[model samples]
Target: MAGCTGATSERTAAAVHGLPEDALLDMGDFAGAVLKYLRRHPVDRLTIAGGFAKLSKLAAGHLDLHSGRSQVDPRHLAALAREAGAGEDLAGAVAAAGTGLEALRLCAAGGVALGDRVAEAARATALGVLRGAPVTVDVLCVDRAGVVVGRAAPAGPPERGTAGGAARQD
Candidate 1:
């Protein structure tokens, strides 16, 4: 997992519990390293989760999951609000939020299912990254309080469609 700091210790604990190889990806060449690792040792499944703010970028197919290297585009958040049927005022609020969590709060206040959209986006990004591999992906979105806000799983075979992907964050 990238950006494995603070609230993301669950991933580290889970990784430690498992009896297998673990590596800290180099931020400079994250995608290359991930692809190489996958090629060297194929896996049956992959699960990724992270903070809500950080996960937004990872959900966008960004291999470099470092917060410093990536960001949640407010435009995307606004689009999500609009897709969820949020009024223009709510969308504007989401777009103007100073932080992802703030945007999420705005969505909650406006009764928009932003978490689901974020989860789906994450799944799509993960699928895009592992486009050709026959791997099952699970994406989970969690909040700062360590609560699951959203989740997604591959529907079926690894077809080249936008249905399945993996990774999540809080």
Candidate 2:
């Protein structure tokens, strides 16, 4: 089983190692804004997705001093990913608990955006977590005038914007 062990090590190395800082997932069809965002800022979603997986075990091993719990939970990782703006990969990685890193990587190939919908979807998929669900988290994209842009809130009813045709924040 030495070969098996070697293979496992190799896979782990890949996950922890080199991946484009600008690389984004290619999940079928991507939206225009996401594409635009990536084109404008070609970075690997802030590297939190990668850091979370790599540092989890190390963090867990020193639980007492760190006042830590049993291990790093998906939500914890999700928070890190969000702060890092790593997007869905953060959700998947934390949710998988080290198992679905590969799938997360694949999904992240399309790229990660700190958008309202993506964060909401990731939270729901990862752990049935939702925005403002005990964990106070809101994804707000605002312009120079401090005006909110992008998503307003899916479930909430639509409201009129200050200017006609302008996007509203719910």
Candidate 3:
């Protein structure tokens, strides 16, 4: 799993059953590491779950999940807040947030289920990334508290405007 926070390691292990071992990788090496592992192990199914913002980038086919390499676009957060029916002040606050956690907190304060929305977005992006791959792909969104806020399986039909498209709050 690609993630920006320390909690991703524990959360991913809990979510993916039968994971024999885990390896930590930097954002620059994440894609290469995954490819190497797949070549060696050849798993039938793969599940990727992590922090919402980092997972979003990974799902979008970007290997760099580092905060510096890939950032949560403030405009996207603002848009999501607006779609969640946030007031202008809340939207502005989200837009100004410097980190994903801050943005999430702002959303919570604004009465928006940001976690769920992030999970959906990450799932869509993961689907897009794994399109046509032999292995099944499942994506989960986990919050800082190690709570599962969103999940998606490969069996479902892809939703339009998802898959690295515009940010959708629904």
Q: What is every candidate's alpha-carbon RMSD to the true fold?
A: 5.3, 18.2, 5.9
Q: Name the better of 1 and 3 by TM-score.
A: 1
The segments of candidate 2 whose C-alpha lies over 4 angstroms from its true place after superposition are 1-54, 59-72, 87-107, 110-170
Q: Write the per-residue lDDT of candidate 1 for residues 66-137, one digit (tens) a residue.
A: 657777888788887788788999999998999999998899887887877776776666555555576555
Q: Compute each candidate's TM-score over C-alphas.
A: 0.72, 0.23, 0.63
Best by TM-score: 1
**Sequence-dependent TM-score of model 3:** 0.63
Worst 10 residues of 3 by lDDT: 161-170
lDDT of 2 by residue, 41-74 (tens): 4332211111222223222221111213234345
Q: Candidate 1: lDDT of 105?
A: 87
lDDT of 3 by residue, 70-107 (tens): 66777676776677678888889988998877887788
- Which candidate do you rate higher for lDDT, 2 or 3? 3
* Runs with alpha carbons beyond 4 Å of true place in candidate 1: 1-36, 155-157, 160-170
Best by lDDT: 1
C-alpha lDDT of all candidate models, in order = 0.61, 0.28, 0.55
